[model samples]
Target chain A: MANKLFDIIKSDLAELETALHESVVSPVATITEIGNHLIKAGGKRLRPAMFFLAARCSENFDLKRVMPLAVALELIHMASLVHDDVLDSAATRRGEATANAKWGNQLAILAGDYLFAKAFVLVTENGYGERVNNQLSRLLADLSAGELIQNKEIYKASCDTEEYYERIAMKTANFLAISCQLGAHVMGLPEKDVQALYDYGYSVGMAFQLTDDLLDLTGDSKTIGKPAGNDILQGIITLPAIRALETSPDKDELLSIVTNRDMTKEDLNRALEIVRATDGIDFTKNKVEEYLDRARNVLPESIPEDVRAAYMMAADFIAGREF
Target chain B: MANKLFDIIKSDLAELETALHESVVSPVATITEIGNHLIKAGGKRLRPAMFFLAARCSENFDLKRVMPLAVALELIHMASLVHDDVLDSAATRRGEATANAKWGNQLAILAGDYLFAKAFVLVTENGYGERVNNQLSRLLADLSAGELIQNKEIYKASCDTEEYYERIAMKTANFLAISCQLGAHVMGLPEKDVQALYDYGYSVGMAFQLTDDLLDLTGDSKTIGKPAGNDILQGIITLPAIRALETSPDKDELLSIVTNRDMTKEDLNRALEIVRATDGIDFTKNKVEEYLDRARNVLPESIPEDVRAAYMMAADFIAGREF
Candidate 1:
């Protein structure tokens, strides 16, 4: 099913890749070098794909008008990742040295800003007017606010499930939701359909983030492109960790290790054991299923059947992917 | 005359202040705290003032419509300064602890991003359309590119005058020029007048930056709100130092001091003395005068005479200010 969806949007995805590459070209050689590095780095391009599918579902789908916005959405995602790597002090992403690790934080920060500017330039050049710009700007704000909230919550073992949901909603879900909303909007979809796409995107995005957190514990470093247990090591309390904190018998040891400024290898190994022993992973998987169900349920009957099927398949992939 | 210009824009400036303060308010407490810290630190509000004056210079002056863009412009300037303080590792700015110095690099980076996002929100909320957003986004790209170029050129003793101009043009002048351009644009000015305002702004912005570079060597730490000779200490080759390297008998000494990663107080003092002793300050002063003259010459005859007078006075102040 996922393969079918990929095949459907394959050409649009290729066009998006070209647009993304062309957007990052700059007069500054170093900027071009760093930007191209990020572009060439592999991403699933899920956001752009979702955007394209949503547009195709609309009554007035025009590839020419919607392509730039689709590309802009992907660029925003990339820009956030670049800055996130800086904030996380991440050494590698997708098995490649991060821009921050290679060129230093100064250059990385500027590169992120450069990508963001280019995104806006694309929006403006393509005549996506005030409403779209406003939506994109708000997404930027939500992304930053989510990061700020996550930064403040680091290592706080007492952080609840609700807070975890809020953080991921702002950090991950909002952008995805807006991407779908924008795709529908640009194609002149009715308000009801736009809202439905937004809901669909939101539910799927939540499942995507929950699965990502689970992968941080269960996935392999090579397959996932970074070390397993990275979020726990960094003291970030994701959904699984929070669930484990609530249910694990060795809650004290788990909290201590997770909250420690520097955890030894033994501590990390033991914390992983504690989390795995609990229902944390199972609980997270169940939550993903719930959100995926909601995503499937939100498909408006008005959407084309094939588009709905593709979106459902995309949600399934997001919920079930191992890496 | 500068005071007269300020007097004219006094109420609007106050309103802009309120708007800026309100714009940074967030649901997140830390973001609000850090944002207010920047707002209360006291800047001359030069960008907002210039924007207001430019709008008033237009035939269809309407404060209701233009005030938001003016505030947005100032926010962009403030956002850049916040990030710049991080890159410069600046401890103090505007006679207060910088956001980076107070909150650490992590929060400071987030704060800078928060401001940029809020600036966009303002643009969107105020219905500044695609053209304005495009220009603003391009200006952002220019700012980042300029910073990258400056970072690359640090401590290169052989850096030439043309390179220095190019860097400042991107880093500083473009923002100011765009502020004027946006103001004229919002007021429904013709292309010719809008171009005139942009030219006027570009020339004045160049003079503004040159004066600021001069102040780094010559101004008092207490008055300028940062340490004197900071550019040299940081290995930033500003205009005066570039000229000094070219014309001073102590060229090698100046070059060595400027290029040193760590310069002691005595080294800084000696570099300052060398720059002062040479024709560097005089050369920079002449350059400021040249730009200021160009600014004055570009004012459209269609602009209200009083508005032109005020803009000319503002240029004079920029070129002649001590700090």
Candidate 2:
């Protein structure tokens, strides 16, 4: 299954790189310098993979027709991350210093705007519109709101799990679902299949994030390329941290650290131990694997064996990803 | 001519108001406060007006059907302005303290994102898709490039008029043109009519900015709701300032004042006087009025008299507004 998807990704891979590089900003004199800088920085290109894989499963699927949708989803994800870093005041992303920290918030904001414009332009030129275009665009709205809500709740040690689920669902999972759903719909897939992809992708995304959050607490900096406990440092209350704070005997003790700048490396290490010892990482990672299993179950048993492997690969990729 | 447009504006007022208010974002927990502040703080709501008016003139015009297109245009316009202020470090808009200044850059950036989300939601929810929705989304990409170009030219006191025209055409005029184009397309207008409205709105929006730039130098604070010559302080290189800087005997002196913050109130006043005396305002404003005339000429004489009147009124509103 992964092999077929990889072949598809290989052919148009250059197109994605080209569109992202050139369309990042108009040849405007001033903002382009900073815009180019961020666009050039590497990203994992994960969303596109999911898009290609999911679209190929549909009888209506056509890889040539769906490249722009794939690009659009990735671009929206990239644009949001750009803005999110500025909002988070993050110093680095994908292992490089961020646009905002390096160039100031003004350029970062404009650069993100530039990417968004490019994404839409790509979609329009490729003729993704009406129902599919509208649905994907609406998902962007939801994703953006989820980001804002997540930002608002960052470090609220007592933040509700339901809100946490809702926030992450919007910001991370829903777009993946939309990406999969869009690919299927664009190929003119049946409504049921499109919806199934959407459900599977959404749950998988949630699971991916839950595992990612757990890894932020347990994974090495080299493996993740992000500092361990960085989310907690930023006061972002992820699922694992939420669990540990709820069940731990030192719940009130952990509560003070919610806004406390005094949370040292020692504290982070200790919290990691507590979160791990309390089964927090296991709880979230288990939930993540559960979604991946469900996503696997959603695949049509009648799919060509090659296509089936690609879908299975997606499940494997999310499950095995260290970060 | 203005009276006719006003009559149309008056008679079909309720729906536009509902669309405008409906364009207001909902009470999402995080975005509720900041989002509403900008939405409720009324703009002239001109973007929506252009959209609705163009839809009304379409052969397949459905008055009730194109509301989302109208609302979406306004959201895109508003989002751009909110983000632009942060880029420009503008202190006030519509006589109120700006979103960035009031809420800090974080909230303003998030608020702009919220508006953008809402805009696309409106677009997709309106039952539009395919080329129309794709085309509308691409406008954002064009607009962002235009802004990047604008940022590049800022404080280049000797910037040429062509560059100025291109920037405003993209950043300001494109939204208006798209507003009309989408309006017509969504309402099932004849292809010829939709293109005509697009060109008409494009020309009118260019004219609108030309007059607006003139007003930046000459309009009173109470009338324009901004300090006369505020653009000079912000280092925005408007067309009038571009031309005047080229011709003034005190040209270097004027450029210095316009580009540098060291200029006193006296220097600011002198720069304004020089721009005025150089026929800069008249030059720009006359060019603006010419576009308005051209827009009027573009409306096919075969149009119903009422529709023609409304289109001309909309152009006049752009050309003649005090602000």
Overall local distance difference test of candidate 2: 0.75
Worst 10 residues of 1 chain A by lDDT: A1-10
Q: Compare the candidates by DockQ and give the number of the best one.
A: 1
Chain A TM-score, prediction 2: 0.90
At residue B75, give the lDDT of candidate 1.
78
Q: Which stretches of candidate 2 lie above 4 Å from their native place?
A: A1-15, A22-26, A29-39, A58-61, A101-103, A261-277, B1-5, B23-27, B58-61, B89-91, B101-103, B261-267, B314-319
Output the lDDT of residue B272, model 2: 89
Question: Cα lDDT for residue B99, model 1?
Answer: 89
Supply the DockQ value of model 1: 0.75
Q: Which stretches of candidate 1 lie over 4 Å from their true place?
A: A1-5, B1-5, B58-60
TM-score of each: 0.95, 0.90
Query: Candidate 2: lDDT of B100?
Result: 83
Interface RMSD for each predicted structure = 1.0, 2.1
